[model samples]
Target chain A: MSDRTDPPGRRSTGKLIVSYTIVGVPLLYGLVATAIKASQLFT
Target chain B: MGVTQLLDRERTVAPPGYNRWLIPPAALAIHLSIGQVYAFSVFKNPLVERFGSSETAVAVVFSLAIAVLGLSAAFLGPWMERNGPRKAMVLSAVCFSGGFLVSALGVAAGQLWVVYLGYGLLGGIGLGIGYISPVSTLIKWFPDRPGLSTGLAIMGFGGGAFIASAVSDRLLRTLAPEPTAAIAPAFVVLGLAYLLLMTYGAWLVKVPPPGYAPGGYDPAEDETGVEARDITADQAIRTHQFWLVWVVLFTNVTAGIGILEQASPMIQDFFDQVDASAAAGYVGLLSIANMLGRFVWSSSSDYVGRRPVYAMYLGVGAVAVLTVILIGASSLAVFVLGTGLLISFYGGGFATVPAYLKDLFGSHQVGAIHGRLLTAWSAAGVAGPLIINILTESQRRGGAEGAAAYRPSLFVVVAMLAIGFVANLFVRPLAEGASDEDIGRRHRAEPAGSPG
Candidate 1:
């Protein structure tokens, strides 16, 4: 929930970015890695 | 107060409901029983002997089970929060015990897929649900000592393996000469026992009473300042710090799982030039080290704060893995000690992380974020073992001598820990404006003299 009209101090774009990066990157990495590993498993 | 006022009040403060001490024992019951999953390797050796299965094939079963643990938790978090932990615990008990029953039948009938579906899929769902059920509740109950409280619950998870190893070993010996046949009866008995124990734990679990706060709490001294705002589960997922933690956990768990999955073989390979009995003993020692680390290092995090504690884990873990590679099995004592420290840090990483999450995001929807974060564990469960297996297999094929086959794998773990250390460095207190009203309520409910 972004405080769109709020002043910069009240808003936390940095926190939003950090959260996305923290969860998103690893999730992507895990998915890619799993696909690779699963392919190896079937092959 | 009217319903809206009551709801608003609860949004800020804890609703009166349950005992705090009951949480840890409940956690212990579930964790200690589920810890059997880690001991699946014991079954691995036996299965290969009985069914003539490949090591990779057997390992895939364990991997699948662990993956399901994470996936199930992601979905189960909301339900657990909605219904309270009692229902969740009961469900876990049934699923976990029933899984074992199914697995027992699978072993008796010599159906490998049955074992996978039973233990891997069903039992994993139990693990996922049981794992997260207590975390957020405990944090709410002990907002003053989130790290210590969460650590106590998770420590049981680490220690559970120790109990499983001993019990499973005895059961295997008594039930049948072969693992497949012996494992069936053992699974059946263990499943029944865990069902009863976990049900009792679920019965004991209760939420804290409304407006109650931990005694003698103080806010100023807490590592994360009271100025930090709470964030909801959805809002938490939107933050960069959340993803940072995901990476941190992913790397930390993957590195540890790498060593854990291959511990026995790694030890044996390390001392290939030495006595076989000694190698086996080294594996046992590593288990002891891993179990002890959960309590020792995580308890210490209560005093040191989470960042510094994780720094120790990453730094020490890196050195330990490197030492294993460079030492080349020369000194048994050095090898044992290094591996012990590495295992301790591994356990500690899991135990300390819940508190770290509380510090970063406040206690609001911590359960959900923690659930989401567990996806990293699910990923690592597969990644670590696969990497180790592939590397070791290739090395063996290439005619690499003994422990040398393991060197590259150790280096990979080292690199993972190094990355984890960098991520730990980036962790800081959450900003003031970001925390939600729930944290304020939790803070306000505390006694006047208590720290926020």
Candidate 2:
């Protein structure tokens, strides 16, 4: 759904990256932590 | 005037050429913060110790939060839709964070009632408001891919608990000499952190400009297996289709909780070799499955269609539960995989429903309709766990061992799924005559002046 070809004011790639980062970093951390904990199911 | 004017729907409309992709993350921020309610169990033992109360008494706090979440969501859904996501989200942030601060004071003062009023009532309102705040807006923005867009945001609700569980556990450990002593401070820290994060969501979110559709998108080509009809929340509830959908959600959730409510103990009881830590891992794995499934299954619904996808969740999900009973009891792999699949469907059921409602009732009042429908969840939350607990305790009292103790409840879960499947079959499109004009006339008659 990228509007890359849209006029100058339409593109917000920088803001897009920042927005994803705000929620993504914490989500990644939680996923890794949960994955580590879940590894105990095998061991 | 300043803040009020800024938060108005007209003020927050997307500027020309604004990318819609940014909206999901904003929705995600609010969902993730409020999803912390799922992790309230982490504080159970600490609170029990602090208040010198019974486990049931401490447990009441979480129950109250969830019950309130459903009730408030059902009642305030129209208000959120009227006010727009930005203002609703800001209100959610304040009540949610304010809940923590109030609860912290309650903890310090050794008053359990204060904590209930803070976390349960106030925070529950936040959860309810935040949960539905972005849904209708997301549906509007991504009309071509309503399922995928709503799924992206709702997925945060499932994943939020994992983040909260780990973060809250760590905070409890390091914040004070004893975890119980740290409860108040942890609430403060979490409250502040959530406020900052949720505010970012409120700031970033914008409603799509009227008549805006993505380039290359056309409504005539829509293919979700149902013709669209704009039905207000009031009128939507009066349809048989609405209650059928409600039953679909209620039964799906009730069945899933049959496994989740006692994941740790159930696994250990199924296998002699499994310990608390291994069971803990199993629970974590289920959380991952639940989180991922919300995104995967709901996005797939955009293609597979909402009705058929729900059929799979209910129909195939029933088979999974039965498989768990027949062979899963003897095999850990079967048990884990079966229950994990069930839980994924459970989460998927939640994430997919908004799009499902949009398909059935149209986007105009989907959020409010969705809000009213969540009362089913509140009802199921109480019924599911209560039924499982009672059945299992009875089995244990009867001297049943290992998997035998849970066998009866598993059968009940399968039955619940079967019921949901039947309900799914009954969910046909809104009858051909419920035209937009007819619904609009009814809405205009109502005195509330609530926007759809």
Candidate 3:
């Protein structure tokens, strides 16, 4: 049912980037922090 | 329009040219926020100290949260299917954040029961609703790649705890020199922060327009041919396939949580050189594996098909445990790697089930089906720990030490995984006739525009 002829315009693209960033940063932060703690295993 | 009108499913339908990719992030926001429940253990000692209460009393708060999460999800699944994710997300935000604020007050007032009412009862409802909110919508949006879509969202659930664990420690350290004093204000801050993030999720989430599908995907040509029928939640429960998958999940979770519940102490029991700090690192490694596996294995299911992928999760996972039983004491690396592999499978099992349900029963009510299936998790949450603890304790009482103390429990886990592998084999595609009729009956019963 989506209108494929009408592509998501510039503002929509910007919103996508911001939306991903909002969730992405925190997840990345968690991964990095957990990785740091996990590094203790090798030590 | 009023707020009620704004939150309705009709208002939340995807507009022309809206990128389907936006939905995963919105899904992630809700998952990440409610996934904080995984880190509730961080509060146990502090609360115990604050209330001058026993450790078991503090622990009951978590048990209640998980129990209520399962019960509420099962009971509310129909409501969620009817109302749509945006409304559910808003309600989830209110309950989850409000749980924290109310618990904060309870902490200040020294009422353990009030904390139980707030965090346990209210927040558990938040966990239940927020969990299923985005699932069926994601399936509708990504009909061709249900595994990948659901994985992207559920992976957030596994990862949320790591962020929350770190955040809680930092806040507790900074807010008050005495950690006990910090519990109240910390809850307030966390509640407010999660409310903001979850509100963003509520605002952004949208249901796919009716009959929406991704641009290039075709269901008739789908290689697996698993997305066969639109089965209602009630109809789904009556099918043998449903119970088989339920058994599959229950056994898989029971096996994995055996290691998880005993991770820290078990590592030391196995390896003499390992200390508490190193044990903590091992637990962290498992957490990383758990989080990563949710994404990796579930995404792989999109390619390989759900049944085969779950076969790998249980079958290969059993071998991973066997590796620990055979050579684990000989090498620290072997023990960590083997258990870590099994835990990854465990995480994958959790992430993959929603998509699996979608494949078997269709997306119409997959979220509700998924909600009902989580009772397996709730059951395993109890059964897994009890099995491991009782066996390990009895072993210690019988004069066993080192890995010997845990060997019996480890064997039990291997058997559980083997059972799950068998259950996974028994799962068949839903039978054709009854489901089609049920769909017709259910549709007529439903009002127009209902998700189901």
**Index of the highest-TM-score prediction:** 3
Model 3 residue B254 lDDT score:
95
B107, model 1: CA deviation in Å? Answer: 3.4
How far in Å is the alpha carbon of B336 misplaced in model 3?
0.9
* Residue B357 displacement in candidate 2 (angstroms): 0.2
Q: Candidate 2 docking: what grade?
A: acceptable
**Model 1: what is its DockQ?**
0.02
* TM-scores for the candidates: 0.79, 0.95, 0.95
Compared with the true structure, what per-residue lDDT tens digits does model 1 show for residues B1-452?
Answer: 65333222224232232235545665666666676687777678877765678998888778888888888888777667666666777778888888899988887888889988899899989988888877877777777767777776776665566556666777889887765668889989889988987776665565665444555665556657631354666666655567777878888888888887787667666765545555555555665566567767777777888889988899888998898888848875677778778877888788777778888877666777788888988788778888889988898899997788888888888999999888878765554543465444544454322322
Q: Taking the tens digit of each residue's C-alpha lDDT, what string does model 3 give over B1-452? A: 89877899888988778788888999999999888888889888899899998999999999999999998888888898888999999999999999999999999999999999999999999999999889988988888788898999999998899889889988999999999999999999999999999999999988887777677777777653546566778877766677789999999999988899999999988988888888888999999999888999999999899999999999999999988998998999899889999999999999999989988888888999999999999999999999999999999999999998888988999999999998888777643454577655654565532333
Task: For candidate 2, write residues B23-124 as lDDT tens digits.
Answer: 999999999899898889999999999999999988888888888899889999888888898999999999999999999999999999999999999999
Q: Per TM-score, what order, best first? A: 3, 2, 1
DockQ comparisons of all candidates to the true complex: 0.02, 0.49, 0.60
Candidate 1 stretches greater than 4 Å from native: A1-43, B1-19, B45-56, B176-179, B219-223, B226-230, B392-399, B435-452
- Candidate 3, number of clashes: 0
Q: What's model 1's TM-score?
A: 0.79
Task: Give model 3's docking category.
Answer: medium
Output the lDDT of residue B377, model 2: 94
Best by DockQ: 3
